[model samples]
Target: MTSAFSLKRTLNLARWNAVLLTRNRLAFVYAVVLPVLPILIMLAGERGDPAVGATSITTVFLVVGLFPVYYNVLSQFVSRRDELVLKRMRTGETRDAEMIVSIALPGIVSALVISAVVVPLSQLFEQPLPVNPVLYAAAAVLAVIMFTAFAYWTAAWTRSAEAAQLTSMPIILLASLGPLGASLADSNETLARIIDATPGAAMNELVRVGWFGFDGAEATEKTLSFAETWSAAGPPLIVMAAWTIAACSLASRSMRWEPRS
Candidate 1:
């Protein structure tokens, strides 16, 4: 027989998910508008820049497109996870894993929708197709998962749902400016070495390389060398994994079913 707590938690998640999503119009805009706006801006700028061809423009577009979808949406998810509703649901039948997944599902769906809109629209506007679709696709999926997990980890430190907006700002800001960070790091060996040690920088580098089709054995060798030297992506992925594990452990240990004191 189904446990009473699980049933109640599931019901609570379904109810709160709908209510919060419907009530928060700003959340809706952030999901839909923020990612798409950069694409529009890129299209507009492409008309004037003779030097900026389809490939470069598409690269910029992809990087910009990901900011709102992954960063903003995930931030919002983390923030919302701390609500009284969530606190109450934890008291019910739902497992901690179930609660987190249910909370994230809506935002994940929205991110996927934005991604769908981005690809075709980019092509329709004559932006070149991504050079390495497989690599890009992998990077995007990895990014979403990593960021989502990171959001939860961040939420653990946050005091309340209201604080999510402020607490999440640093991540959103970093993600929004990731491309710039990547470029700057690329030029400065020392800075690049430092940024390469950052959490999301490897994903950024991989995506940029994949999107731009920096291929051949030489490129692969260089990427692998960079991977070994800076150990950017590998270390971050491991850190994210550890963070996810730790977050789960913490949630299991500290999570309260009833409202916070």
Candidate 2:
């Protein structure tokens, strides 16, 4: 019955947010449809290419999982604040963490569902299963956590719900570009090093390692054992952890509870 962390209240808020999000056609399209576009395109492009590997499919899954969470969560937070929903909630029994989590729950759940679906679909397409399930789970969890923190950071500067798209673009562009840049890493070392440090690229890299048992930079058929997965996971994990800390720290400092206007 802890008021600060009431499970019942949190679940109620989450359910309400999920219902609201599903009703917004625009939000639903961006959260659910937009992310799927890239995967379809990839499936078409790689249709007969025997060179298409599990790494490529894993990258698609990463995109489907992370981008929607970032965009939808940012929009939700800003829209609620602009409507004074966040302000009203502040006067209620909801705690800060609960408020944020509730607002983010719909998008988070959508991302998770998409991530889960990606696995089975990949299997259907003949892509190899993840070599280390633990690493895959860890990467997925960390990706969501890191992006959620960055979403809050972006929301702090967003003045209105309509402006959320524009304000969230920088992070979105950075994250989107990172994976694309990583895809071309074999041809470019400098870009590889830089993109590998980015949150999105790091997440994708971890997924590649977890599923393929080899980092994207080193394409090998050798399966990574338990200790090897952790070893390969280290650098990307560090990079993601750094981004998470920086984003959360900055967001905690500047986030506003009331409408900025």
Q: Which one is best on TM-score?
A: 2
- What's the count of clashing pairs in each model shown? 4, 0
- Whole-model Cα lDDT per candidate? 0.52, 0.76
Give the alpha carbon lDDT tens digit for every residue of 128-198 in model 2. 66778888878777788888999899988889878976887788777776557646788888878888887
In candidate 2, stretches whose alpha carbon ends up further than 4 angstroms from where it belongs are 45-56, 183-189, 218-227
Can you give the lDDT of residue 259 in candidate 1? 30
What 10-residue stretch in candidate 2 is worst by lDDT?
A: 46-55
**Measured by TM-score, how close is model 1 to the native structure?**
0.68
Q: Please list all clashing residue pairs in model 1, or write none if there are none.
A: 5-92, 5-93, 6-93, 91-257
**Candidate 1 vs. truth: CA RMSD?**
6.0
* Residue runs of model 1 more than 4 Å from their true location after superposition: 1-19, 47-83, 215-260
Q: Which ten residues in a row have the lowest lDDT in candidate 1?
A: 215-224
